[model samples]
Every structure is written in structure tokens, then in C-alpha cells.
Target: MESGPAIFAGTTFALFGAGLLLWTGARVLHREPVALGVRPSVSLISATLSGVVFLALGVWCFGRM
Candidate 1:
């Protein structure tokens, strides 16, 4: 059923979303450019927005089940 696809896709989306949010926090908090391979001027606001969107999308998918 479509529920199967939703669970699989939603799980994947959530995994990456959590990883992204965690990475963003590490980058912003640690300020280690080498760790994240990002520039010092990286925008935290955008990162937060993207992470939130993905997480919300993932949750919505799971809710469809």
C-alpha cells in the first residue's frame, strides 16, 4: 500500500533532516570550518529554515500513514 512508501520515505527524510540540523548546530557552535567544510560566513538562518522544512515534511509524511 501507499503507506509502505510513506513510511520508508518519511524515515529517510527524517534521518537526513536530523543530520542536517545537528551538523548546522555543530558548525555554528564549534566554529570549526574544517569540520563542516563550510565558510565562516555560512548563514545559520537559512540552515535553520531548511532543516525545519525538511523535518516538517518528514513528519507530515509519517502522519499520512
Candidate 2:
């Protein structure tokens, strides 16, 4: 399998995760009310986990490359 796709995928995932983290952090810090019945803690935790997963994937992809 070509490594190019892996690298791209990893980078994309990382970027998406980072964006989520930032958005969530902002919402929490701003004390924004929850939308769609979602809890603040849930959003924050999800964002953090997503960021971690993406970071791990990016690292793995970089190693493969």
C-alpha cells in the first residue's frame, strides 16, 4: 500500500480533531449553553478524545512514512 494515502489521512484526521478541540474549548470557556440537548462536559470530553485519536493516528502515519 502506498504511504501517501496514510499520510494524507492522518493529517486530515489531525486537522479535524484539532478543530473540534478548539471549538469545544471555546464553547466551554465561553460558558455557552448546550445546544441539541448535549451536555457541556460531553462535548468537551468528546473533543478531547477526538484530538487524542487524531494525534495518535498522525504519529502512526508519520512513522510509516
Candidate 3:
């Protein structure tokens, strides 16, 4: 079903996003530089955005089915 795909995609996105958030948080806590050329603040913002997006995706997926 279409809902199956949506749930799978949502779960994948959410897991990846959570992982990124945890990694970024560790980097920030350790005062380490990011792999990308982006600044710390930018990276943090990006991570936060990604986490929010994934969380929203999960909510939407569950809500739909």
C-alpha cells in the first residue's frame, strides 16, 4: 500500500535525522569542528531543522495511517 511506503520513508528519515542530531550535538558539546565548511551555528541550525522535519514526517505518517 502507499501507506507502507510512507511509513518506511518516514521511519528512515526520522532515524537518520535523529542520528545526525546526536552526532552534531556531540560535536558541539566537544567543541569539535564539523566536517563541512559550514560554521558551528549553521551546522547546529541545519541539524535542528533536519530533526524537526523528520519528526514532522513521522507524525504525518502515523496520522495518515
**How do all models score by TM-score?**
0.79, 0.75, 0.76
Ranking by lDDT: 1, 3, 2
1 against 2, candidate with superior TM-score: 1
| Stronger candidate by TM-score (2 vs 3) | 3
Top-TM-score structure, candidate number: 1
Model 2: residues with Cα > 4 Å off, grouped in runs: 33-35
Q: Which candidate is the best by lDDT?
A: 1
Descending-TM-score candidate ranking: 1, 3, 2
What's model 3's lDDT at 12? 81
Tens digit of per-residue lDDT, candidate 2, span 1-65: 69889889888877877777777677778888434477767766766887778877777777887
lDDT of 1 by residue, 1-65 (tens): 87999999899888888988999888777765523455555567667777888888899999999
The CA lDDT of each predicted structure is: 0.79, 0.75, 0.78
Off by over 4 Å in 1: 33-42
lDDT of 1: 0.79
Per-residue CA lDDT of candidate 3, range 1-65, in tens?
77898888778877877777788778878989755798778877877788778877877776776
**lDDT, model 1, position 32:** 57
